[model samples]
Target: MNNNCTEVEDPYIRYVMSQRPFGWNFTDPPVFKPYEFEKVDPFYWVSLMEDNWKVAFYAAAIYIVAIFGLQKFMENRAPFELKKPLFVWNLSLGIFSVIGFVRYVPGFMLVLSQPNGFYRSICIKDGMDLPTGYWTLLFAFSKFWELGDTFYIVLRKRRLVFIQYYHHVVTMIVVWIVGPLVEPISRWYTVLNYGVHSLMYPYFALRAIGIRVPVFIANLITFLQLSQMIIGFTVNMTSLYHQQIGNDCIRYPVSIKAFSLVYGSFILLFGKLFYDSVIKSGRRQKEKKLL
Candidate 1:
């Protein structure tokens, strides 16, 4: 890290330093480094996938074929009673989500507490390093594991909603592309996702274990999903506005546009899900009681 704040040419950094107290240097090395992967890069292969569009295309093709193929295969079969395995899977993912939230959020908060840390958090110029990088990489690869979510739906012979599959497909591609790039704003994406998954997976786990979860709790998760999409869209738009003004913030136009489209769609889909699951459902129940 450069100590001479005056020599830093990046407008974002300069702005950060300008907000500091006299003689304070925003360029000073941080007191703590974030967590990092040890022993080996667990995400090495996934990182390689980012190098070519063909890899993503191939993976996506396989994913689509497998989903439809499985659906066809199970057309005449009875639903699998996967209660025990489903419980384990959801519990594991919930734990992982909690771990991700714990590992990354403190570093984020530490940066945000610094002078102009809020701006630094959103427009980090140096890119992700240490534990945050390791976890962010893991977060990206986790999307592949998430594909199994739909598999459970298919094996259980449940109706697979278009929104559910669409979200899974786009997420796999987006994370693969954006994770390796390590845009600063990507922190928002990871943090919000981890936060949601932390709650969501545990809820699913409980249900899988035959614990009766309230319908409202499930509604809350969907609401959180909608909120995440809205916030993600807003963050991307903010970054684009900053880029347009030549603020010297780190910006990736391609990722921003892709996120806009994906999250924009999510807003509509989740909104509909929320209305159908909560509002419409509640109205029908009320009508039932009145009858």
Candidate 2:
């Protein structure tokens, strides 16, 4: 299905457009418009969620300090030992992941099915027309539930890596911030991530349940994360380029450069970590065997 607002064009283009598959709406010119009303302040939406931000930040801060402090002070804390509570946590995460994944694949296909324009699927002006916001809101709220991940580690006495812990907490904050603050690409990223997590968290859950999942299967989650980064970068880049050239005729409410940089950097960092942990470790082990 073609998912876009047909742009205003010359008479000849309009004549050709009349023969197109989907009917076109030719009332207004395809000029860029900010999401909010022209008179409304840009900060209004963000301000609505400021209270949520403060709470999330403080909670994240406390967790960070406690996790690190406990790691230093406690020597025997570890996730190696299996327990009933751990099993329950894993099962819960598995269920959540499954639900998340179910929504993601279809959502992704919808976005991918859209034609050339980056913002066409869920543009700032007419987002109501697309289903992106509904999924995004659900995905955003799910982050709050995911805060339990760190709690699981703390209870099990596992060493929470700085990156993983920080990524979790900060991402919760970021997703919440971006949800309503500005126009996001919406369901595209959320679906991809949820689908991956669907598989990933379940793997952890199975392991927690004393089911020895193959190492290769767990590695698939890492691969998915890397793929997500690549796709995310591609999407953001396309959005920025089209906006710059005015080809898409969509005006972003915020700085696409800033968004792209932060998202891109996140993918790069995570990609490096995966390589070091899995690929590099495998290579080193192989080298030792050769020696």
Candidate 3:
């Protein structure tokens, strides 16, 4: 391997790789590698799930029906506390997200630091690198498990808001579509989601266990979610621009459109929720305090 990036013609790639941030060495060999077994690979299994669109659609259909059906069934029954179980569930997800964030992000940053790394990361197959690919595959599969979040809400007789269910449904579909594709741009979504979940789930777990977190912390988490959507939408638009210029970027027209629509709507929905729940409510409390 030449290991010399000067031959690369793309200016963007050269510029990103040359900037060493905070004394981090981008040229160092990767610390992690993809896992494999005797003649079998787990990442392949996750990739295979995306081979058929019906599988994702069917899963989404079942999810919608089950949540609504369970809601109706619970209408006549007393609400379940489920405090302990919910605590454990949230804690587990929090830990998983933390691990994912730690594992994938450094490697991605390292990749970006290499010669022509930005271009390689975006345009090359498996350009996210092996470790990222492995973790990302797991992240995709984990979305299905996260559907349990709604189950807890329903059982506790909490109101199932449209944003809650809509987030779950669309996220599942989007992860399935883009996860296996492993487009370099999709890495931004994975990293953002993992970072948010790492904080959000632990907060949920603490609250479930009777630890009273400040209200502002909850509002902060919601703000982070909204920010993630905005950033994701911005990234997709950038990718679209690169695709238009024929910059050797992987072009997934349908996936790009889906992401734009989903993230764009999420921005609006989350903005409203944040205003209603945080800003408006905080102002009311301030007025009461004054009185």
Candidate 4:
């Protein structure tokens, strides 16, 4: 529901907060406060990010270099059996992502609960709550932390696919740059990621501990990954469309288009992965069952 934004400093207004079904006051802007510190400015990282666009480029460069270097270094080395460590690594990430999903998803829903929520969901920046704000920052930095996934792969001499490493490189760069911005569409990014990874990493943790997960559960995660891409592409296009129609809240059309291209590529990548891992395999499994 599009209405005239109320103020220059804080634009949202809460005239009918009583009638709001979710009981969240949409009028007050959400401010991100750190977990236990009042000394820190809540918006400090966001301001820093605005001035440091090149940080993403530098981070990506470092990550790509490290991936290859590790791959080379691990050559001729006996693969380390790191069962306990790998289990801890995946379990920790899975737990962190679970917390993030809980903190962030509610705020995302609150933004969408508003009138014209779809537009606001794509356009408004301050719809996030205080906890979501903190978790968003953590999730951004965690991209680099999650690079350890490749470390495990390389050290264990596992087949490191191009998609595995490439996906990590791109996300680390993009999220480092864009995470603080917390663009309206990033609500979708943050939620889907935390939600999906809540299952994904834990699944890995189980496998790391040598537990066999059901085939359907594994397929569901892959399917959810594909769903995230399709949703990303759609949301970006919708935001771009709103921008074209002159919504000031939509802000950066260029960034929207760039994200669209990124999601478009992912759609193809994940689409193929889904077919090979799920659809095609499902057919073969069914044929086997019949026999």
- Give the lDDT of residue 127 in candidate 3: 36
Candidate 1 per-residue lDDT, tens place, 234-273, comes to 9888888878887756656667788999999999999998
What ranking of all candidate models by lDDT puts the best one first? 1, 3, 4, 2
lDDT of 2 by residue, 36-61 (tens): 32223323433344334456677678
- Which model, 2 or 3, shows the larger TM-score? 3
* lDDT of each candidate versus the true structure: 0.76, 0.58, 0.75, 0.74
Candidate 3 lDDT over 73-168, as tens digits, reads 999999999999999999999999998998888877776777977665555444344556567777887878898899899989999999988988
Question: Which candidate leads the pack in lDDT?
Answer: 1
> TM-score for every candidate vs. truth?
0.83, 0.70, 0.83, 0.83
> How accurate locally is residue 261 in candidate 2, as Cα lDDT from 0 to 100?
62
Query: Backbone collision count in every prediction?
Result: 3, 1, 0, 2
- Candidate 4's displacement at residue 266, Å, is 0.8
Worst 10 residues of 1 by lDDT: 20-29
Alpha-carbon shift of residue 130 in model 1 (angstroms): 1.4
Tell me the TM-score of model 1: 0.83
Clashing pairs in 2: 78-157
Runs off by more than 4 Å, candidate 1: 1-49, 126-129, 289-291
Q: Please give the distance, in angstroms, between residue 173's alpha carbon in candidate 3 and its true position after superposition.
A: 1.1
TM-score head-to-head 2 vs 4, winner: 4
* Backbone clash total, candidate 2: 1
